[model samples]
Target: MEPHIAFEDISKIYSNHVTTVAVEGVNFQIMPGEFISLVGRSGAGKSTLLKLLIAEERPTQGRVFFEGRDIATLDGSQEISSLRRKIGTVFQDFKLLSNKTVFENVAFAMEVAGKNDEEIAEDVPQVLELVGLSDKINNFPHELSGGEKQRVSIARALVHRPGVLVADEPTGNLDPANTFEIIRLLLKINEIGTTVVLATHNKEVINTLDRRVVSLDKGRLVKDDPRGTFIL
Candidate 1:
């Protein structure tokens, strides 16, 4: 079978007046249901790789394929939307809507996807329960703690039941205690068969995972360990 996601000799360069190479000749394949962590320091191209995967940034060379379709060639908005639906993303910032309640925040994902009210009602509660935020459904972003807000973000990301979830520095804003909570939640999500691509610089968090680790340094892939730790 084909890989779920593949990057073939991919490279990205940003230029206007000054030229900056974000990623160079990066190649990897993520299998279905695999839990993989991308480890790197700042400016190591981790974010560029994640952006390439979701087609937020186009490659300067080579191709990024999602389930065999080259993302660079995906020209239509409909196709891009379909691709995004299959890949959920979470960020360090909770990115919650201040005006909406927790339930509404999660439901908004499905709502914009054209899901019916009944489906949104059924799925929102279930996803919130998964993130341990069922009781906080009526709360808003300002009403929750850092960890709780992140949990709400995770719930919103999972509402569509995507095949792969990409988290970029998800624990950056949390305390150590809350960091572990979020990691455990991601692991649980991976356990139930969602492929997880976690991009983080946290040594303790990466060390604890003990899963596949791909290390990047200065826009190049440095190492890939099957049972890896965070080594710089």
Candidate 2:
């Protein structure tokens, strides 16, 4: 069977007054419905690798493949946008538009992708309910709690039914209870068949996941195992 995602000998380097290598020669494969976590201390290239996967950063040396197509070699702007539609992304800061209501925040994603108003009208409310934010639809980002903000962000990401959701330190700013809640949401998304790639340092959360764990250190892949736990 073909893997859902794979990174082949990927590397990324940043050059300036001081040269830095973010990730080097890292490779891995993810099967369908598998939940994976990438763990490391700061500057371990976890985010760098995610950037490469989505084509935000070109690999300094190698390439990545999604659904068997080489992402680095993909042609056509519209096609690239199509690839992104299948992958959801959530970040630590809950990148919600501060001025918009939760409903508009989620619904606008569909609008940008050219989804019809009728489709957006049906989808946005369903997604907000999925994220447990139905009552808060009228709330602005500033009015919601941190956890609520993240859920709104997630609702937006899932509005198009992304095949995969990559989260980078999504719980970084949350309290312990909120952290668990967000992680639980990610797990729930995985249970629904959206491949989840979470980059985190919370050992307890990783231990609770009981899924594949990929460890990285200074741009190199150090460990990979089924039912893996977080360890550096």
Give the clash count for each candidate.
0, 0
* Residue lDDT tens for model 1, 200-225: 99999999898999999999999989
- Against the true structure, whose lDDT is highest? 1
lDDT of 1 at 134: 90
RMSD of each: 1.0, 1.3
Candidate 2 C-alpha lDDT tens digits along 93-188: 888988899999998778778899899889999998888989998999999998999899888888888888989898888899989999888989
RMSD versus native structure for model 2: 1.3
Model 1, position 88: C-alpha lDDT score: 87
Quote the lDDT for 12 in model 1. 97
> What TM-score would each prediction reach against the true structure?
0.97, 0.96
Clashing pairs in 2: none
lDDT of 2 at 116: 95
What's the lDDT for all of these models?
0.93, 0.88
Candidate 2 weakest lDDT stretch, 10 residues: 73-82
Deviation of model 2 at 202, angstroms = 1.3
